[model samples]
Target chain A: MTADPRDLVVRGLTKRYANGALANDRIDLHVHAGEVFGLLGPNGAGKTTLVKQIIGLLKPSAGSITLGREDFVANPDTARALCAYLPQGALPLSSFRLQEVVELVGRIRGGDAPAVRRRVDHLIAALELDEWRDTAGIELSGGTRRLAGFLMAAVWPAALVILDEPTNDVDPLRRRLLWRLIRQLAEDGSSVLLVTHNVLEAEQSVDRLAVIDKGRIVAMGTPSSLKAGDRQSLRLQLSLVPGVDPPAPPPFAHRPIRLGQRWHLGIDQSDAPEAIRWAQDRMAAGVAEEYVLGATTIEDLYIRLIGREDALDRAS
Target chain B: MNLFTRWLRSYGLMVTWELRSLRTVLPLAFVVQTMISSGLILGLGFLMHDITATQAQFLAVGVTVVSMITLGMVMAPQLIASQKQSGAYEYLLSLPVPRTTLIAAGLTVHSLIALPGAAVALLIAWLRYDIALSVSPIVIPAALLTLTTAASIGFALAHAIPNPMVTSLVTNVLIFVILFYAPINFPADRLPVWLASVHQVLPFGHSANLMRAGLTEGLASSVGVSFAVLGGWALASWSVTAWVVGRRA
Candidate 1:
């Protein structure tokens, strides 16, 4: 097979601390260019450690990491020049103003001050951080600190940008803005890696994702593909007649969920037709209005891939 | 673009941050130290009518030198330990900066805290003894050696110790012990010859001796050996601290 030009190849990457804790086990990951790749895992599952190793913050205990074909271990400065990383809740220096923090990070990453200023100005404006641009980092609100971190990561326009938990502590509106920015980065041909605990958020935003558990990748694919390959589960919303109580009659018994004035059930896709048929038959017998069936959501696929228990465990 | 420039940038940023923090804490420390010394000496000097004008001058200079040593031992280690605790050192390590920059920045900031204490002590001496003070050519090298030595020892202690509070307390005790009971605390003649030999070997004793030799008129001839000892301590301490930092990295 031809070597992929637009990808980072991590082969047998392992990191063992001196105390003998293996933060990252032997693992491999491929992130294609122009595709937003989400690294999903629970806290301490090595998501941050793996990302740090990928970005050259920590050397792997054993393995080779290549960024677009360049050996990162041998020349980390050059490799790092090609990527930007926003560590989890990375703080700007307390003494530095928001604009100074962005400009300094941008400059260190090889952008000129004037050019950095323009880009930083645009990012501040885009993120609605202009009002806080001159405020010192210690004085900013938590969400503003997050905005500063996002600006620092994006201000340089590096080829690959890794953001760890970019949405945590951010308000919903700014989270939407951040998601849009990640999409825009990939659209502009820069690979984006998002490491997060928010599976639903990743599902809505990532072009593809890797679900890592206990230092290993358990699943990797487009969100829909991962969800679809699990034999396609369907969710149905059905309204029961006023006097008809819900019946739990089958082993694939309805997983009760609320949708408007009806009760929803998660069922195997193969059984969806029969289940819908049953629902329709009930409706004819005097069931209420509104019966619908739709493709499985990412949350459903995530549950199946990792198993319901594992998913809930990871989520908790 | 070059390693030197990278080193300079990193070292400059750290030094700026260190100096900013030192400024916030140094003034109160300087005032407290000065007041304590002045009060103690005034109460004691009047009781001892045999204290000569020259001895009074020596006493003031001794207080200042002791203050420098105290600040270096107490303030410097606490600064380093606080940076370690605050995650500042880890943050610095994450950058592309060389390790020597961290050491240099820390030393430079601590040495700066010594400057004002030294100046204030001199002013008190000039007022109390009517002594005309000049920047003697020997004082430059001597003061630089003393400051550099004090800073390196501080760095080494800070690097070796994990806890800031414990380090500061231990350093303060060490500073007091070396500066108070040793022959270096007074004229060398006041000590038994055997104990004087022992006092001369202590790092603070050497620092105090060197400071006295640089400031006093009759002791100018002894400044050369004092400079050499001070320089030797500085070099040794820096190497030790650097090794510790390298191992950490």
Candidate 2:
């Protein structure tokens, strides 16, 4: 059966290298039109490889990709025509000025000259890239170059836009602006595949998401849905006073993850009152200085699903 | 658009992009290539006092052939490897243009940039050696074929070989062998029978032979075979390049 032109459908997608390392297993997912779908995963979680396959940069060892009523494997040019990709790092067009790189991609990706100029101007201003507009890509800061690359990826009218870690290396203020632009892109009816491990920000942004780990999707749903999946579970995080022997985390069903002076404990939602009661007892003893009890976050779900927190925690 | 028009547009875009980026360095690149290619001939002129007319002619034409060889065989791999290493290769692939159009445009840009060096070498040789240069109708076509064949071989190797570093070194080795060891600027009889036989099959020797035929009239003992060999080499090089560039790395 054919998929709608407004959707990107991947079925039984697998990428096994000649050395027999399965980078992507028999995975499947879909992103409908006008939705921002995030593929959240830790490093080496097969997110980039899956996107590369979808973009025709790598051939799937098995199964197929259906994008906009065409098989992406059979008709990749058509698939590419309907998509725009912002790869993982900075824009690679070092020979051109920042603005020129944007306009060049616009034209090459099928925009007319006049329209390209106007669109490039709008994106540059919107992204706060005016100061560095005349600078060559080789000379621009990494953050500025990433901003330009993100803007260029959004220039053309591709139904599906793929962004791999769009906010990486960007400063805090620019990162906020970037998230705003992504929401605007979705509002304009582009289906965005945002591949990132920035769970907190992405939790607020994506309409739905899939958590992939070790070539398999361990979890899939909207942030709310995934969080709701474990409605029985809630997170208990406490910031203890410095150098106080942090008590044995009161035996959480799943091990508590420690961050600096804080200990994050997961418990059944029904046990929240008791957990808070226990935390309150510790607070009275001046052990836990501050505390936060809330529903499980996309990050908590991430740490639980991937089962490898230290590396991803530090990276994200 | 038709295939021809589409390719022409792509060629225009690629060439324009190349020239725009290279505006400041184009002059210097051309001058350096010319000097690097012909600098040896100038040294030979200055150093060799008792050189005969045959030796001077050999030196003149040999420098011209070496210029094209260096441009095609050595320069192509180095430049392409640099582009690939810099992530520019993926950047170009992400564009809407077809691979063939890009490759054609790249070859065109490379050949155009490379011509001035060979031309300068020929001019310097013409003046330094007082050699009689021929205005043969076949000269330009033969030169184009020789340059394109050598360059295509280089482009093919750059994509095929797993290690770009080694490919670059090998091109240098090939250049040295052709210049000093092969009978490029010397008599074929001086080389061993086995070495001469090897040159008979390889296009490097035929490239110089064809150029020699165009420069002077009576040296064409096997002109037909030389043309065939160079043309075949060009065709084969392009075929291999198409194969390697089309595959995923």
Candidate 3:
């Protein structure tokens, strides 16, 4: 198949701030048309820097970013014209009513007035924000404001839609609606770049994802492909009693991760029974509050990847 | 659409957005501005028991200039700094509109908001002092230049400084300097010789001179020099603001 002109191709993209800090180090990635691509990384992992460059807010230190036949870095106007961005904070809507903000952005993005009004109306109804339509931004709740911001970006039709932490502060029901809207955007043939640290949500939403750590893509693949190595292992999670020290991992278990009162142990499938027995014994002894055995998830893989990078840095 | 049409459309939309966003605050801003301008005129009047006509004209026109300066130099910087702190400025930059249009829209809205207070101040000055002001067409360019220069400088300061708190502090200090220290309400001759020389280069004194020349004929000297100085400052400050706005990374 011929390459779609709307595909976002970034080759050897790098960004080094003036303070000699490297934010994005020779990153390369491709987001095909009509694809839901996730950039999953923890805060300060260069995800935002990458998005900023793509939207032409930051000049890349090196490499090229092309959306269709246009160069994004060299032609930032094209980037602005073709990309719809929902920045990762409360939008500056304090003085504006929700409906006004959405419709204004749509019109500014060059949508016909009536068409934009219709689109705004549709989105407001879809997200069930009609009650808050006339409410000023300052009066809206955080979740409602975020939903309005989403509508502002989604009201316009663009080749690429970049949403940074769009689900942040959103209620669960609205978040589900947002995810559906995101899927709808992709289905309508727009490339959707979902920049978020929520691995569980990204796993469910993205067609493919890249895990970034320390300004580099540590791993990139479909969710299942990235988790394939852990397929033979079961994640044994133990929630210990408060103030109790974590129990030691069994010989068959990999290094255990302690997060607050919870301990996650990776064990082979064959060793699941022994792991369960150990967990049960700990619970019986009151050392553990509860235990759950589940398949390895993308969050585990993300932590493992970041941990590996940390180890490599120490070695070097 | 052609580039011009596109720019005009974007400019119109941005102006609308800014006005709507400022709807609640605009009335309050107008009230505060009117109070400051009218208060200055009436309060300063009490200080001088026997004021001459020239001094009356000076204070009246001077306060009008101060009202214009306050919007651009004090309020604009504060607003922009707030927007920067809230990440709204960055969001605006990321939009699919020409950056110049945003600046233009801001200037337009601010001018609209400030002019009413200025006019009210002038009316109060006329009614209270009964000053015979010779209104001339030069007042138009003079007012425009003063507002634009002050706003450009404000925008430049806000954008150049990374910390919003610092920007706020600096603008507060600017308001203080403009109100008391600057040779705006009084003649430069009243200040020390060294300070008078300093006022020659600064835009504040020149802004007052321009307004005074337009409002009361024969009251302001060196009209040509005042125009040149204000224009130069406007150009320089606007250049800095444009660079900051258009810059990437």
Ranking by lDDT: 3, 2, 1
Please give the lDDT score at residue B54 for candidate 2: 81
Q: What is the TM-score of chain A, computed separately for every candidate?
A: 0.80, 0.87, 0.93
Q: Each candidate: fraction of true contacts kept?
A: 0.04, 0.25, 0.84
Candidates' RMSD to native? 6.5, 3.5, 3.4
lDDT by residue (tens digit), candidate 1, B103-170: 89888878867877767766765676576444456666667777778878888988877677777777
Q: Which clashing pairs does model 1 show?
A: none
lDDT of 3 by residue, B153-229 (tens): 78778887889999999999998788888888889898989989998999999999999988998978898998899
What DockQ does predicted model 1 obtain? 0.18
- Can you give the TM-score per candidate against the true fold? 0.76, 0.89, 0.95
lDDT per residue (tens digit) for residues A108-202 in model 1: 66677799999888778777767888888778877788778777778877778888888867888888887888898888878899998788888
Docking class of 3: high
Per-residue CA lDDT of model 2 for A26-65, tens digit only, reads: 9999888888999988888899999878877777899898
lDDT by residue (B1-249, candidate 2, tens digit) is: 797887677677766666555555567777777886567787877777788888888788788888877777887787677667666566566666666766777677666677788888888888877987765877778788888888888888887776768877888798788787776676677789999998887887788887888787665468789899888888888888877666653
Error of 1 at B162 (Å): 5.6
Q: Rank the candidate models, highest DockQ first.
A: 3, 2, 1
